[model samples]
Target: MAMIELPDDKPVRHPEYVYMDYARHLSGRLRRTITGPMWHGPSLREALDGINAADAVERPIRSMQTIWEIVLHVTARAERARLRMDGLALDEPTPEEDWPRIPIPCTAAAWEYSQAQMATAYRSMAVRVCEVMSSGFLKVVEKQSYNIATMSDGVAEHGAYHAGQIVLLRKEIHSRRPNGAHVTDLLW
Candidate 1:
């Protein structure tokens, strides 16, 4: 099939690309930080693995959340926003409300299962977003109720904030290890 070329005079819109860019940056940073066995660093898979290993007791500490929780929260937020970006609604009729907490697994097996589910959700959002980018459906600025600039800024800022938190969490976890003798072990 012959490819059709549009006029170069007008700028093309691509909100999905905009969002995809933010996701790429966010995911990259997460993957690179948290490191170990099932808990290796520098990738999304490893980050989640490390997060899952977090102790049940150490998981929910006020502003300091377990890694799994953080991943779930980000995934849930992204999924909800993506749905709205695609012109979808929440299941059933309720007032526009907060994003629901994704139920996580209590035991190891359940934790892995929940992690897989969370991964699926995150991957789904990535796929949908990429699809929107390639299909050009996200090209129009009006297609986004919040527009590309606002959406992009929100994603960037939120991702960075959470990423910073994860880094702090990892440092705290590492510091508490049995052989974790030195203060510099985590700091420097």
Candidate 2:
């Protein structure tokens, strides 16, 4: 593929090359939106960084859910979509699965494990997205009406939405601290 330099002096694949390898282009774009630095703000991984178990489990507002529950919920949604994309015959998520019950004590180990699970689910989703893109078959087998490209984009958007919530919850929790510490101090 030929490279063309734009006005900004950034070389991009030629138009012809892009058209010929549209699937690869789509895969790359989806991957970047999911994990790479986006114009809006931090990606999902960045949003969860440095959050301790106490912070994860704390419900700053009685009506709202904890950061841990939100993370698990996001993970469940993404994993379910990924499974469907992979042609797996998994049952639809129940309300309990959608909002998973956080471990009673919310220990550091459990918090870390939840984080790992979220990361793993996202990674799996990304892999399936690439596979769908590479196969040049955007339409998911399970849902004839929906295409993988659209679904992948939706998943990325979903992650960003949850990430924003996590940020807001972190701020709320930090502001409520007894020592009156700033949330900015807790964030990187």
Separately for all candidates shown, the number of backbone clashes (residues 3 or more apart, or on different chains) is 8, 0
lDDT of 2 by residue, 43-114 (tens): 666777667999998888788788899889888887887877877655666899889999877899999888
lDDT, model 1? 0.48
Name model 2 segments beyond 4 Å from true: 2-36, 89-91, 141-144, 183-188
| 1-188 per-residue lDDT for model 1 (tens digits) | 22334686555546555656655553433333222111222333443334444442264346665665666565565556567547564453232233334355456776576556645654555455444543443343343455433443354345445555665666566667788734433422
List lDDT for all candidates, in order.
Answer: 0.48, 0.73
Q: Tell me, by TM-score, which candidate is best.
A: 2
**What residue pairs are clashing in model 1?**
13-139, 31-42, 31-43, 32-42, 35-40, 35-41, 36-39, 36-40
